[model samples]
Target chain A: MTARRPYAGLIVAEVISDAADDALVLAAGMTGRILADLGADVVRRRGRDRGFERSTELFLSRGKTMSNESTGELLGRADVALVDGAVLRERGRAGLPSVSAVLSLFGGALAESDRPASAFTAAASAGLLAMVGDPQREPLRLGGHQEAFALGLSAYGGVAAALASARPHGVPVTIRASLLETLVWLNWKAVPLEGYDALPSRTGAAAEWQVLRCADGYAVLVYQEPDWPRLKAALAEPALDEPRFATRGNRLDHLAELAAVIERRFLTLTRREIHALARQHRLPLGPVWSPAEAFGEPHNQARGLFEPLGVDPGVQAPRLPLVWLDQAPARQAKIAVGAA
Target chain B: MKLLEGCRVLDLGIITAGAATAALLADFGAEVIKVESPTYRDPFRAWSAQDEPDAMPPLFRATNRNKRAISIDLKRPEGQAIFLRLVRRADVVVENFRRGVMEGLGLGFARLREANPDIVLASISSQGETGPDAGHVSYGSTLEALSGLAWVTGYQGGKPEVSGRDVNYPDQIVALFAAGAIATALRSVRKGEGGSHLDLSQRDLAAFMIGDRFAAASQGEIVTRQGNAQHHYPLQDCFLATDGIWIALSVPASALPLLSDGLAVGDSDRPDGLRKAVAAATAARSAGEAVSFFVALGVPAAIVNDGNGMMADWGEAWDHALQRDEQGLIVKGFPLQVDEAPLAIERPAPQVGAQTCAVLAEIAGYSSSEIADFAAAGIIETAR
Candidate 1:
């Protein structure tokens, strides 16, 4: 059976549109498409003579149709506005009153402020950079516009919630999911350490958990004490039987040594074998798949997780992330990954 | 002025994923019944190992605000019977139990569907319900690792560093998606479309978040960590300002003249030179001064704030995002604002089962004596 398009018929056959600035297109426009996939009549209104990066533009427009309607005209027709702060700055909020909900995916309060609000700036301002890289080295940005998707997803909820609660007495929803705020939310588990004597020390390639190299590829493991014996059995490594690797604390004390033993054992097994063993032992382990291999993943394919972007038969371009089984997004050409 | 003022949700969440989902709905004015157990409450309640008894943890407080609480012993037949009645009245049910746990409790989707045909059942699990590894145990971090995020994070040439301290980034991600799904499902039900099960896999969501990585990986390309460097020019990376502060930016070649080394870096076209030149140019200025100077020239630039930088008040956004409880604790703000609807807790998260009698009397039509009987029989507990 076809997945249900839960958004259909709620908004008069659907009404959705986005008109974000060039820099903000990926997040705002992508959010529009996600909403559109849910049966909203989504559209992207380009600026009067402005141009955009083709892939970014196409990524946003792949499933949804496009219109050159001015920002004002689009907002007049849209039930939900997936707006960019850049549009608010350029066009002003005069046109904003018509839409039922507004999800601003850029600098919210920071839109007009001196502080920067791009994904980079937001990440920095939120102190996410403090926890991302090595303690001794400079902060590194995560690959791709990592902050954009999170911000976009939040914007979707902001807009969805607005639509859900609209009434004569209800307030129109207006959410400004600051890139800074989302990043702050991302690091919520790390309690604020502003005045603490100690800050989170970065551990470059080292983390409390890791994706270790296996004989053929990589493995994802979440170490637990009860599973140590099972892990030892899976690897059949005599070294793992020692008392030093017996308990979680002991393993921590001899982490390097334990890791050395595990790494050597992993060298003898392929990723597939490791996963099989993980399942057998109920170990919290999985293979570390590359994007290339993700499409062919047995589980994902069986679940229909990856859809061909329909870009080409030979050239596979996987669709965008943020899958909803109810309303899977439209197929698009594989995005030029890592493209700024 | 609440947008979701009439929507009623049954929050059967235990961890961050389930709780945050319900919280998002509550933030938007949904009447969320945060259902916990008297014996086995949401682990998030005593989140901090050191938290005082009966005193809620900050994380729990932040995510659980703006919702009513009802502690029912689902393991008991009477409690499950009461919950089934709630199922008939609720618009949605959000849960993150291990697979089949609900079925074991006789509260599975099929069973709930029989009770309320239009009920939206959002089931969040580690690896989705249909996958080969569906039964595998995982935390938010484990899902992060399996999704290729952990492999790609960290410094260039460095091993993958797990994202977040103890926070499972995927849990929150799943929450956002789950909320959206529930909203859509509710809309569908309004249009006469039946409610359906929403099976969201934390692992799938993680892979989707880093979707571009998969695009690159599709061609046998593995883009390792490149600290602060975008796929474009190296000049687009982060740099240190004169006063020991870090700044992040990216300027196209057309605007190269805006930088002090515009001529040299533009002409040389070298990553190392660009990095050096940008650092050299801003070496004497403080981070704020440097960023302002760039903004003045219409360049996108910002200071790379560390933990210390995140401390400043959030300005106007804070007015709508945060609320304070009677204990004077400032809870995290709802990420969204519905025009005049600034979401705040009607009552700080009801003490576990604080609303047991009110809920039972109101929804299940339970008499006061029945509530007392249940409490006496260990079927439920009410807050003192």
Candidate 2:
């Protein structure tokens, strides 16, 4: 196990954020979390209260080793330093190690000083909001600091690439991941209706695909063109037998009628019933569970997605989403890393 | 040299989740070849609407750039043999299929390891492998709802909401997470360790965002949505300006007068009044301008911008990345930059099977006669 862990005990100096000198973005913080999840000894300076809410700290600070050391002392011994571009410009990359890898999210392309604070506004400013959600209404942001999630992911990939490229030799390298650019990259992927000049307005909220109320809660139902025959079979309703529901465009045209018919049918079933039907029909439909209710989910339970956090018996550590076969230090990684 | 210059990746990803993962590796200088079959082409590949002769869709081009394309039919033994040989030479294989689909097709991790003892097989799925929901079908929106993102996203009083359009954030999350996982696995291999399967769950990951809700709920706190607010702080909120622009401010009301000299709340202690006053103040300027002003003054401010406003904020960089194709259609490039070293786009997305013969010959060491014979035997498609 010791032989397998090239990542084990890698000291990552995280130049953390605080309220007095707030220099953190949710996306950028999430980037640090990504490295921590891979078992880095993340050291954030203990400072005045963090600029973010306790929730942000709890989410970002989990799995990190907080410290009171000066940033200089920490970075001197650290293998990786996660910093935003502004920090690099101000501090210069002089103190970074010969083998050090720096994962950075650039300051705003417009005003370098204008670091984004909200995932919603950042996403919107990136043109991501423009292409997402209902086209008629103001662009809809997904629930939570999603911009953090987006940039954090790119940061995670950048850090991972940096880690993989790390060597006993070579000059320090800086990997730059963009927040606004990442948002732009993700928001428009489909063939834009407006061609390349601009992102076409998203269609209205009411589409062929949506969440419908079930007996217990809500369930998302994907009644696409491919699933029409099987969906009609599962709905087993004569109301949907109309010629209006035949083609994709017609189905969109009569989406209300179709939704009403499906909603009524769905109302009679629990989320479990819909899951079963979805599997049988090969359609993309499933229940929508709240975070609390997710604990009872059979699949999550089986996968051991959540581990006990030790503070409370009822509380569990967030289930890690990525399993590394490299740092076979983890229980799952031993078998996952093929040497078995 | 680029970080992953020597790495080779076989991407059997379908949606944004898989292509985006491969795209990351490609951007970092890995040789990532997209493996798809005409019979099972990626669902997102229908990017171009009209028959424009392989004019890639915007989404497809954005996520699938920096990699070559090849098609292989795993259903047929000959194709599987070719793919297995590719796996032997490949360092990483990434696929977004639901659990057991690969095993069912004899391309599961166990089989890949048999072919190459040091190959990392990353299975990117909505629910991870081995769970009851592992076999369940899910899209990004459904995952959003189930993962608790929907429950926490809407306004303080509004019901749980999803994207109005099918904009799934979890898919992108899975892509990056998987890419990182693959890179991690690659590091172990670089150090002479064996490769293993990476089981990444997008559903579990997206749900992890609302982990704070779990802590709050566990403490017997009834957590509801905050909309543009946080922890029920009256001052931390988003308001629509008189001119119809939206901006979010996280500062308390007490600091407002000091932050902006002209604005005065005048005992607007009530939440509604404060909101109204803030709205009035913001309405005087454009959303982008207000954001810049507040940011300059050390207040966290952001305007709710769309595609147009986004370009306005990040103009030159955005303009440089978003280029015009031969048809003058705006196309985008990879956003991640590695200083002065060029992260080369080896080629545009290959037409399915366009590189079948070439990849098989170059990577799999298949002879021309063997490739021609395989094509003759109906095991591979060498043309569109």
Query: What are the TM-scores, per candidate, against the unseen true structure?
Result: 0.87, 0.89
TM-score of chain B of 1: 0.91
Q: Assess each prediction's global lDDT (C-alpha) against the native.
A: 0.65, 0.66
Candidate 1 local Cα displacement, residue B16, angstroms? 1.0
For residue B7, model 2's alpha carbon misses the true position, in angstroms, by 0.4
Clash-forming residue pairs, model 2: A19-A51, A27-A148, A124-B305, A143-B153, A189-B59, B47-B57
Q: After superposition, how far is residue B124 of candidate 2 from its true place, in Å?
A: 0.9
Q: A1-340, model 2: which lDDT tens digit per residue?
A: 1223446677777663343123244555676666676666777656555345555567677777788887678767877776655556556778664333333333334424434354445555555554444444444556556765666676667667766763324445566666656666666543243335534544533565566787887877665566678888876888887888777788778777777788899899998898888888877777777777877788777766676444456655465576543332222233222110
- Residue B127's lDDT within candidate 1 is 82
lDDT per residue for candidate 1 within A122-218, as digits (tens), equals 6666566656666567776655567777767777776666655545422244556655555666655444421224445344444455556788777
Instruction: Report how far residue B180 has shifted in candidate 2, in Å.
Output: 0.8
Fraction of native A-B contacts kept, per candidate? 0.39, 0.45
The candidate that achieves the highest TM-score relative to the unseen native structure: 2
- DockQ of the candidate models in sequence: 0.30, 0.41
